[model samples]
Target: MIAPAAAVTTVPRSVRLGYGVGSFCTATVGAVPGLLLLYYMTNFLAVPAWLAGVVVTAPKVWDLVVNPLVGRWSDRTRSRLGPRRPWMLAGALTLPVAFFLVFAGPSLRGVPAALYVGACFMAAATAYALFEVPYKAMPGEMTHDYHERTSLLQWRMIFIGAGTAISGVLAPAIAGSQGAQGTLASYRMMGLTIAVILLLAMLGAFFGTARAPMTGAPEPDRGGWREQFAAIKGNSAFLWITVLACTQMLAVSMMLAAAPYFAAYTLGDPRSTQTLFAALVGPMLLTMPLWVRLARRFDKRGAMILAALMFGGGTAAAMATPLFGALYAHVAILLVGVGIAGVQLLLFSMLADVVAADAAETGKRRAGVLTGLWTAIESGVSSFGALIFGIILSIGGFVESEPSRPVRQPESAVTAVLIGQTTVPAVIIFISVLITLKYRLRPPAAPAPAASG
Candidate 1:
């Protein structure tokens, strides 16, 4: 049987733009929290490294449950605004407010402060799930053509680069330095700024995709997720892609979490956080079109392998930052940024394919569960990167300090930060390259031409 919308070869550029605009939500939310939140908790709030890790990660644990439920709920809904947009709208209303409170509330340090931040972060995570799981579900439903999905996701990659660039560079500038000393007010302001950006992007996507086609059938899976899990268990391509995405995201998250520490201790300049991010996101922005072409030439599998190797090698080389100095580290990270473009584009594009293929085969609306599980894995491992780095810092005896009470980090802490950012993530990313080899998503064959009378 022909799949739904199989004959629809192209998504309108406007709808692509509208859908792609939502990535600002993912990139901004993902980059800012990973970049600054751990540092914010340890330095500004005086939370211990291990506990700060918990504050960053605990909220994401909530995702493993909530994301799937949101996915399932959307699959069942029949609404005038459509199932996904309503959830997107709800998230837009709630996340910005919750995100602002994360940094703006309760100046008290230690456990009291940690609890306040943790609760706010949990709320933000839930809000993110509301939009993100449903948002993720849309690309697969938008069209069925394999290459068209890549073309569609090309827009998302560009927007992701922009959002990541804005958040990565701007957040550090707004949050002050690593110590952030005596400038809690600046951190609060940064939160407000990021919140506003999130609001605008989410709302823009809602309005932008005003005429997006809902090609996927809305026959909700009545059986619980156990049935969906069984379906996923048999799907090898889906499983491998999930592994690749999760491992890569974990590495990215670890590096993002360690950026502030690396700038201050390893590079001897806290301001270099902005410079490092500029280098990182600059390459990401400039190379996205190149990566999209590479996906076409090499196929997503070969392209992913190349991208993973580039990221791992560049990140591993960055471990020598102390020996080579700032320029060398910057150049190495720039190379890593190039790989990041392909990694994200291919991963997202392939995900849409696998989900769409599954929906076509089963003749059920299981994309929600599939995407829910994917997001849960993505969100879980991504946040786990922070937890892993916090463990590394604790082992190195890093000290926590209030904004008014600055303290020197031991050489051991500095070394730990460098290793956490470079060596650990490099190894993890290389592991993803191996998993990428296991992915074998076959593109659907084109329909036969009609015979002449």
Candidate 2:
């Protein structure tokens, strides 16, 4: 069956802008906790390092249950507003409130505080699930055009990159200015701001793309969840993609966890944190157009493979910290960041094809279910990433707020940090590249024609 709205192609420029901005808001709210939550819990909130890891991991475990369920439900829902948009609207409001509570949670001074924080995190996780699952599903449903999907995502990443850049740079500055309880207050402000952004995005997507057609329901599945799992497991493309996604997520967590440490200890300059982060994401903003050109020239899979290799090579180069100055670290990370930039821009486009192909093969529109499962995996990976990094740091003997200045550690521990950020991810990225190569996707025999620019 021809997909609805397939005859017409190319989303309006305004709609694309709206999607990009909305995505930015979502990414900002989502990424800050990933970037700062562990540090905040372990250092600022005075939680035990190990316990902080638990806090980071706990909510993600819920995705194992929540993500697939939401996806399945949305797929089954019959709504006037469209299946995905409703969830996005609800999540848009819910996310910011939950986000604020996560940081504004009761004092972490006692057992009550820990319980309070956990509860707040649980709430935010639920909201994120609501917001993110639908947000992710929209791209697949938005347009059937393959390159259109890439274009949509390209803009989305632009916004997401901008949002992450703002939050990453500003969160620290905002928290630092607030003094003792300032982080808490800063979080509240950030949450409110992010909420506004999400709301705007929701409206734009809801209204701008509201007229866009839904693929409607998928054909019946003979079995239930068990069968679904079996199908996905049997699909080499999906399986490998999941493996690659998980590895990338783990690697991302490792890099984020180690970045601050790399700056402070290896470079002996705490101020370098801002500089490094800026360098990492700043170019993404400037280079997004070029990234788009490269993606179009090569297509998503080729782009992803190339990106992975670049990241891996750059990561390996980061190993030469002693051999080169801080500039080496900056340049290596920037290269890795560039590779990530391309991957981030294209991975979802590939997934859209995977979902569509599965539907065509099975006659079942299980995008929501599949996406939910994907969300569960993505969230789980992110949470696990945090946990994994914490374990790495703990094992490396890194302490927070040492009673003494210039706290000394065995050289081996420092080496571990470097490896965690560089080599470990590089290795995993290479494996992911291998998985992507193994994936064999046959596009529609007669694909739709593209619109002229």
Candidate 3:
């Protein structure tokens, strides 16, 4: 049931920016691991491709259980800091330290190193959920106006662009450029720098949202997981959107996991990973307003379909890079970046609407639980990208090696990276477009008339 926009007082500029900067946490934590972790394990830790996939994936599957639990906990928490911020604070404190340790470990290799990375990655994933699940729920609580949520998430997308640029472009440069992909010091430097970025962004969000107004949300107690599942089952909009977004995430994750391999082996340069990231994220810095306008004109679901087409087209076009060369790949990725800007902005904006609509209909505080379930599914689905790519690498006979002992991969392995990054992701994205067609959600009721007094 859609609720009236309920005369939502526009969120303050300070609070909006404060809330917006939180994506720094989301983007960095989301990007760094996908961008670097798989390659890091394969090249530096000497973990075989298939086991490395398991190490990356198992921790995220753990989130399928943990994230929803934290969401439910925050939904019930009572404090001066509010239900969400307290958990945000907790994640801010723990994730940076755990992230640092994931890369800075002893010079262990093979299965032992894989185990160490898995444990630390698991801890980092837990910490991320503490901040992310609750933090994502805030926009739904911040304002009820449908258009206003779009405005608010615009600020967030800007920060997301910055965060992704740092993680996607700068992190790779630090890891691969300073020495090579084979240098322990290079990977350590990459880990430390990214950790510091995570700390600053997470802390900034915790403090920035101090003054934002919280519209009331469902305060349902932990009524057990089955009840929670029942609530999710009943929200059609929420279910459809989650399915749509998770499919999109799987596509993005595959691209991130295969990027370094694609650059080093297919494109003939390791440093090209940095340039590829720049092309992928650069348009985002300037395109949010255009996306917001598209949402206003076409509605979010329509805009999402258009964006999906662009993304899928770009991904498919890039498959010709080996034939057309790197310049063509960069241009194709630029189109993907423009599409990414719209999709990223609209996905969360529409999500806020779904949660807010559910709150109005149910009269229960299930934002945490709902967002928890959302995060858990998104994280778990995304892990499939890395896992699938890892399997591809194994089947293609990609060789694993330590930093000090690099190995030449087979011609088949290079082809595997190419197909994984381009053809597979393109197919997944087209499927998401089909899912988007099913997500015919109503926008929130139009804003109530304003008073002049």
Candidate 4:
């Protein structure tokens, strides 16, 4: 078991900053696909809505299997560069190429184009799993300090907000050049730009954490795959946190996937997507400190509950946009942003605590196994969210708009967009709040001092 003092020791500012930089890449990777991929295929490439959903969901399904394997491999790894950094470096080299292929595929329509995207996105998701599972495991290894973990994740959320803002605004702007929404050329440009940013940010994390200490206990045995499964199955706290986080992730994913459609049809201004995303993400940057303070004063679980309510309420209220207009809707979305910041800032911190408790109990470090399950649930649930929304869009009979021509959507399709943007997420977030209420974790005990020499 790690001593309390060792667990509570403060992380250096430099190491914190270096680890935090990785979130920039993560946010870009998450936001672009959630926000644009469905739109890109259905509207830009003229793929059917159901097929587009398949393209988006297939890669994540692959992650369900790959993440755990990578996690277990990372756990057993022994290296001079440390168990995690090598994987981070490998991800830095491969993720850019995989991401580029997602939007830069051959100009083929129908099933062929859809198949191409599915294959490329599967590659991207695999590369991301290589980096993310190990990266998430690092915070637990970095420090056992309860509050310090939250503090570290707070820095990560800041960059997540920044990266989301950049990708949300710039990607759409580039893709919708001169109000010509869903141009293939625009998507290609956006993909190239994001690919470069992903490579740089990931490499920064790799080199930055290169010399940082590895705090996880040395592997006791070469844990088998069955042992990894048993480890996660036995940890109740891990299960609850995974459920809560993935549910929230599902709600957030739905909103992200629905944003473009809502702006195009419900708000009557597709160009407003840039501003809408700004409103949803900008306040998150400013309010992250406020959420951090709340966590310090209260508990992380309490803070997360409050934020979930705010998110659900704000999303429900935003449905009244037709009555109150775009300005009013933006205000509602800003409230949702506040909730988003709280969840993003605290969930991983809580996960780190869970990892610590598991290590203390088992006397073996298995951060990789736990974090692998975490990332897998997040990826799977979020991708499932996209699939659900795509089915809704198809049911509503959404029309695929041409780049140089307008397409009229049915009234039902517009209504479907409204429901996806508001009611669906509102309901999902409410459920997440309920599940979070069941979480039970107290701060780890402080370690006793050593005997006098």
lDDT top scorer: 3
lDDT of 4 at 14: 85
Question: Positional deviation of 322 in candidate 1, in angstroms?
Answer: 0.7
Give the distance in Å from residue 62's predicted Cα in candidate 3 to where it truly belongs. 0.6
Worst 10 residues of 2 by lDDT: 400-409
**Across residues 1-453, which tens digit of lDDT does each residue of candidate 1 receive?**
224454765788999899989999999999998999999889878899999999899999899999989998988877998878998899999999999999898658899999999999999999999899889999988887777888889899889989999999888888883344327888898999999999999999999988988777557677776777888899887888888888999999999999989998999888898889988888666887788788879888998999989999999999999999999999999989988888999999999988888878777887778898899988887889999999999999899987666898888998999999999999999889888878878665566899999
Give Cα distance to truth, residue 272, candidate 1, Å: 0.8
- How well does candidate 4 score on lDDT at residue 328? 97
Candidate 2 TM-score over all chains jointly: 0.87
Ranking by lDDT: 3, 1, 4, 2
Question: TM-scores of the models, in the given order?
Answer: 0.96, 0.87, 0.96, 0.96
The deviation in Å at residue 70 for candidate 2 is 0.9
Residue 297 of model 2, lDDT score: 81
Q: What's the count of clashing pairs in each model shown?
A: 0, 2, 3, 1
RMSD of each: 2.1, 4.1, 2.2, 2.3
Flag the better candidate by lDDT, 3 or 4. Answer: 3
For each candidate, what is the lDDT? 0.88, 0.70, 0.88, 0.86
Candidate 1 TM-score to native: 0.96
**Span of 10 residues, lowest total lDDT, candidate 3:** 216-225
Which consecutive 10 residues in model 1 have the weakest lDDT in total? 1-10
Cα lDDT over the full model 1: 0.88
Clashing residue pairs in candidate 1 are none
Residue 373 shift from truth in candidate 3, angstroms = 0.3
